[model samples]
Target: MNASEGLWSHLTGGALFWLTLTLVVYTIVDRLSLLARRNPLANPVLHSVWVIGTILVVSGTPYETYFDGAYFIHFLLGPATVALALPLYENRRVVLRSLVPIVAALAVGSAATIGSVIVCAAIFDLPAMITISSLPKSATSGVAMGISQSVGGDASLTAIIVVATGIAGAVMATPLLNFLRITDRRARGFALGLAAHGVGTARAFQVHPLTGTFAGVGMSLNGLLTAVLVPLAASLIGG
Candidate 1:
């Protein structure tokens, strides 16, 4: 092979190329988002997913091949999840005061989120496995995969559902909140994170620190609740 052609093939085939390309593309979109007055519609995660997905489709890169290169970024999800506690701790007063309500809301929200999906899927005559898998779509993607496994659901499908759920919530958050007159940043953040998980948390950070902090709490709490409740509910139903 010619030197330039060989080098191009080598770079594209390497993990560094895919990983760096992902980050650089995401960064550019994030900056564009900011330039657009931080428009909610111009979300970085939404755009990044679109751009990367398009690239993969165009390049004929198998999902597995892309994931192999991107696994390092995926590995950091655990650390990022644990780091969510810091913000929750920073707002410990709010957490402490609303502990009862937080727990109560989580229970109801988790149940409703899972149950609603199941019901909708049933009405549409979706396969049982798909319905079960989608139950954890509101949780963080990693946790959703685990829950999907436990519930005999498809992990890959759950991952896609989780991202779709996040993008839907992130895009609708501003308009919905304004319409509902939900002016409290903390409340908005919490609702978004509860509904959207990490993607929503990122969007919250773009809005304000306080918003992001509460979003962190909601994201973590909702994930914890769904992780525990979903499998148990599946068992109860399956039994």
Candidate 2:
């Protein structure tokens, strides 16, 4: 409406604010990665997202406008998810042999993921949105957001929590696994991805390609299961 607002919006690509920030942040993260020690916790995607989010908040840019530009990046998520199939194929025999355990683990893990969040929220008397947001922290962003929304959570918050949880899992999984004496590649991979999603899969790849393959398998399947289960779980709880 005002000249300052008009000029700022125009210069900022109006609704595409998030897109510009995403690119800029990603570029910075890429350079930093090359110029420093390669740390899994310093993940480019996670770091870029944080930088972009911080700037948007500081600038008072509405999340809706930022999401407009950010939505373009989301389109790639579908293809990237599908591409995980290649890794899965590379480990097909092991996958088949371990299908039962994987499914069982995923089922129990999914329940734990949602249950722990909900129980903690109840114990702390957290608001409904925060409680629901944590329910999908172990899922991929797209599926997690859907599940969050279905359960009366704010999808954007769910996205942030999902990313944060994945990063934390990626960072700590190796040491934790070692402590637990869980050295089997397939089991480690499955557990990490089931609990941590994409970041865990990326960390798994750092150790071995086979581990990455199984991690990818766990991440993709769990995402699907979480999407369906979250809503159903909410309904049952509410009922």
Q: Which candidate is the best by TM-score?
A: 1
Once fitted onto the true fold, the runs of candidate 2 whose alpha carbons sit more than 4 angstroms away are: 1-9, 14-20, 34-37
**Candidate 1 lDDT, tens digit per residue, 7-56?**
97787677888889888998999899989988889988889998999998
TM per candidate: 0.93, 0.85
Residue pairs clashing in model 1 are none
Q: Candidate 2 clashing pairs?
A: 18-66
Say which candidate scores most in lDDT.
1
Candidate 1 at residue 24, lDDT?
94
- Report the lDDT of model 1 for residue 237: 56
lDDT by residue for model 2 over 1-239, one digit each (tens)? 99998887786755455577678788889678656654666667678767877887888877777777778988786788788998888779989999899899888988888888878888999987687677888987777888888788898898888888888888788889999999899889988898888878977887788788888988998998888878876776566
User: For each candidate, what is the lDDT?
Assistant: 0.86, 0.82
